[model samples]
Target: MNLTIQFYTMLSMIGMGAWVGAALDTYHRFLQRPRRKRWIVFLHDIFFWTVQALIVFYVLLRVNEAELRFYVFIALLCGFAAYQSLLKKLYTACLEAIIQFCVRTYQFFAMLIRNLLIKPIIYLAQALLALFLFLLHMLKIIFLGIYKVLFKLLWMLWKLLFIPLGFLGHLLWKLVPQRAKIFIARYAGFLKQITKVKGIILKWWNAIRTRLGGPRE
Candidate 1:
């Protein structure tokens, strides 16, 4: 190659070497190999080296038409050595600062979204639920009040009819013959005895069912 082409290739190789060093540092910083499983670290290392090789080859192709020479390798090594000695610390610090800033920004946005959107939606749902429950409570009270008022009115009407019927019954009793009155009394007594017997039988049945571990109803 001409001297001009050689110089350009040398410069490109040096720059590429420095870039590779920086990329390696960045990869290690993010990868945190010590925290990863051995197999996982192995896989990541393989991938990183493969990608770096491909990038280096691509840059070499761009600068020197894919030429391979001893001086190119020497220039690359010098550049990498220089970066390790002079730039590693500064680059690592800047990388860490940038990563921290990104993390903080994400956290801030998440907090803002939660406060502005999610919290209001949650509060609105709670308020709607409370309003629904309150309306249901009010409806129950209103219905109960109506039921009580209707029941009281019916009770009063029944009382008014009952009083007149009781007076009519007494007059009818006075007009009834003595034999018919005796018959009615005997029938009522028989009915009362039948009811007592029925109640006694039901009690016995319930007791038997309870002993058998069955429901009485």
Candidate 2:
């Protein structure tokens, strides 16, 4: 279990790295002025080049085979180049997957909240109104218990419906046409928008918590 947790943590870290990598690509591509390119190049040389040198040094210290180390270094450099060239595309695909996951999860949670909170509120209001009407001699409380049972039954039915609907949403995405895939390829922008929204929410929540004692005991 500990190993499994560590593995998952590593994956999460890699996902974060990929996210940062994508953001970096986006920033450099669109935001960098032509005159600032020299500064950016200098920064990249000072940072990533140093990292590359360290990787080489580490490989040389650990490897017994010189040819193997050379090959590894070549592969590493090639991978870095590929990563730079394809970072936008890779990030876009990752974001698309994330968006799909978020949408489905949101739908599931919305259904749950509607059933648990909203439905109960509506039912309570209706029950109160019915009770008032009955007291006025226009109705009876004979079916109050039956209405209670129906509320419970309706919630259960909705839970079942949304669960299957969420699954179907996932399934439908898998059946998209190849032509539409080209249009969907701009998913990194979608991810960026979502991340911006998340950042705003985080900031708002943090400020509220800092001001108030937050959740009551």
Would you estimate the TM-scores of all the predictions? 0.79, 0.29
Candidate 1 residue runs with Cα over 4 Å from true position: 179-217
Residue 195 in candidate 2, Cα distance off native in Å: 91
Let me know the TM-score candidate 1 reaches against the reference structure.
0.79
**lDDT tens readout by residue for model 2, 28-98:** 55444565677877786577546645554444344432233234444544545555676767666776688
Deviation in angstroms for 16 in model 2?
A: 12
Candidate 1 at residue 47, lDDT? Answer: 96
Each model's RMSD to truth, in Å? Answer: 7.4, 41.3
Best by lDDT: 1
Give the runs in model 2 whose Cα sits over 4 Å from its true position. Answer: 1-20, 25-81, 137-217
For all candidates, what are the clash counts?
0, 0
